[model samples]
Target: MAEVHGCNIPEDRYYWIEKHVWAKPEGDVVLVGLTDVAQSLAGKIIVVNLKSAGKTLARGKSGGTLESGKWVGSIPTPVAGEVIEVNGAVKANPGLVNEDPYGEGWLLKVKPSNWDEDAKALVTGETGVASYREKLEQDGIHCQK
Candidate 1:
């Protein structure tokens, strides 16, 4: 993991930095979640709405929406895929997104319909960290807590 302005960017996961989302491929499904920077920017998440399992999403489509004291925005899918599952824990306690944005706060599991094509739009490893760092610096964004 690389920390940029207090925001964590895990090297192992692919990131859609512009969308503030991360995707970690696990076998046939990919785990999706908001990045730490996103949670920090949103400020104390209050609600999480995710698309139901079996729903198909195009790349860049909103898988759902999130509401917080400071922000309200859609959670975009980084890859075109069918939603396999949603994290019940996040729905029940939206604060978990602020508490653990990359872990227990994960929003969904999706079986990608076009990984190779979609992956071209994402960044990972050192490239991702560098890109995210640049964006954070450019936007003057930093994670709190």
Candidate 2:
């Protein structure tokens, strides 16, 4: 799980450690979101700047933006892909990020151009949490969210 501040990380998703985003795969389709830890740290989200559906994104590039009280940052993608849908729920109620960061708060759905090549770099399962813990310690951040 993503142990940033003690939030529960969904076991099935893949994570981008640096960006703190999660990617849930469904065949060629992928769902994206800020990890539980990321959302908790961000505090309240006032607004989200989402890329349009059908927009093509490159691997490791920012797919959209999250404007929270804590910091304004880009949400990165693991795979180069075409976005199929942007979360309407989050658009209307930005606070959903805080309420359910891993589920209904999901930001987008994508059709990755290359799943295998891109997914290779992501962290999963227990190793993912270990990796996140190292990063948190390196940043001198304490987590109990």
Candidate 3:
């Protein structure tokens, strides 16, 4: 894990910095989740509504909706894909996102339409971590660690 402004960002996942989402390849599908920074910014998540399995989403489109404290926003997918599975646990206990944004708090599983093409839009590894740190600083955003 990499720490940027006190938020834990696992290098194993690819990030859509502007969207505040992460994607991890898992065989034919990819797991999607909120970043720790996103969870922290949203405060305590209270509700999550995910798109059903089989729903096709365009890159940068809303894949789900999350409500936390006074904040309610969409969780966008970094790539175009079909939702393979929705994380039921999040719907039942949105607080899990705040507790563990990258683990049990994952949003859904998606079978990408063009992973190779879309993945180019994301940043990963050390460069990604550094980019996120810079973006957070520019936005004056601080992780609530």
Candidate 4:
């Protein structure tokens, strides 16, 4: 993991850095979640609303929405696919997103319909870390907690 400005960026997952989202490819499905930077910036999350399973989402579409003390925004899908499952734990306890954004707070599972094409646009490994670092620095943004 790369820690930039107090944000955790796991190298194992593909990142749509601009959206502050991560995608972890697991066989045919991808596990999606908000990045630590996002959760940190959002402050204490109070609510999470996710699209139900079987819902098809295009790349960059809003898969769900999150509300926090300081922010409220849609969670964009990094890969176009059918939502295979929603994280019940996150819905039940929005604080999980702030406490463990990359782990138990994962938003959903998606079986990508356009993996090859969509993946080409995501960044991962060392390159992803560097890219995220640059974006953070450029925007003067830092993670809190």
- TM-scores for the candidates: 0.97, 0.89, 0.97, 0.98
Which model is ahead, 2 or 3, in terms of TM-score? 3
Task: Provide the global lDDT of candidate 3 against the true structure.
Answer: 0.92
lDDT of 4 by residue, 1-145 (tens): 8899999999999999999999999999999999999999899999999999999999999999999998889999999999999999999999999999989999999999989899899999999999999999999999987
Q: Candidates' lDDT values, in order? A: 0.93, 0.82, 0.92, 0.95
Better of 1 and 4 by TM-score: 4
For model 1, how does the per-residue alpha-carbon lDDT over 53-86 read when each residue is reduced to its tens digit? 9999999999999999878889999988999999
In candidate 3, list every pair of residues with a backbone clash: none
Clashing pairs in 1: none
Q: Which stretches of candidate 4 lie over 4 Å from their true place?
A: none
- Count of backbone clashes, every candidate in sequence: 0, 2, 0, 0
State the lDDT of candidate 3 residue by residue for 34-120, as single tens digits.
999999999989999999999999999999899988799899998789999999998999999999999999999999999999889
Best of the candidates, TM-score: 4
Indicate the TM-score of model 3. Answer: 0.97
Q: Write the per-residue lDDT of candidate 2 for residues 71-115, one digit (tens) a residue.
A: 898888777899999998898999998888887899989999988
